[model samples]
Target: MKKNIFLVLMGILSVVSHVCAQSLPQETSQSIGIIEFVLKNSKYEDTKCDIHSCQMKSKDGGVSLTLTHATMKQDKEEDLHYLLKINVQGTLFSTKVEVRYRNDPSKQTMKTGKRSDEVDSSYKTEHRVLRSWIQFIKDSTTSKS
Candidate 1:
């Protein structure tokens, strides 16, 4: 009987330890800072104006930028995806930029929906622009101040 109790107690302890071994939340403010920095230096035009809704622009001259909404996805992995809209504007023309970044890497593909007239017209252009945005993000670390 004592042996059985010991085994049971050991099992309980093992389970408790296992549960306790689970990773804790590792998020930090630094990541947010990196994101902000990246967005600022993304090389899109109009890097200064805060248009809030409808109109969006990045300070860089390469792509227009706007952040619609953001949320933390519930998953085993520590990750987040941001809904971003980009507009490649020029002297007389413009294109759309729409994509999401998972865990800060733009290479990760995300499911994007059709553009609405209510949404920024710049975000309605082409899917290929996502790659450009990703490229800009990947190169961002080098230009950090």
Candidate 2:
């Protein structure tokens, strides 16, 4: 009778585990694809964007965005917090950019800060503010250029 009871308990445990696994949150492939597309198509004016790296497949549902001496990582689903570190020219400015995603209008912006030469030792530094936004532009109508 004890052996039968043990087998029954094991079966119940296995079933519960399977159910939990099925209900666990999973990152969709579409999100990764969108990020890759944007990164590949992004361009910086005269300055070249090098050493591009992305971590959209994070286990904790966090995504990392980096370019050269700049890095930004955020996990809105897990925690409503973001961290940004950027080094432009010869100046280093680190600040948090407010991120909002809702009602079909998503926006992100960073406050101004005085730049320093320690950020990058190759060029002059000055106070500068950087703002970036991403929007889905629908190809409504196309004409020959």
Clashes of each: 9, 2
Residue 136 lDDT, candidate 2, scale 0-100: 15
Instruction: Write one digit per residue (lDDT tens) for candidate 1, span 28-105.
Output: 123223334455555443333232222334564645555533443422243435456655555554455354544544
RMSD of each: 15.1, 18.7
lDDT of 2 by residue, 1-145 (tens): 9999999999999999986754312222232233344433543222222244211212222323332222244343423233233222212322322222222222222222432211111111111111222211101001110
Query: Which stretches of candidate 2 lie above 4 Å from their native place?
Result: 1-29, 41-145
Highest-scoring model, lDDT = 1
Task: Estimate the TM-score of every prediction.
Answer: 0.30, 0.20
Instruction: Tell me which residue pairs clash in candidate 2.
Output: 90-120, 92-119
Write down the TM-score for model 1: 0.30
Q: Residue 110 lDDT in model 2?
A: 26
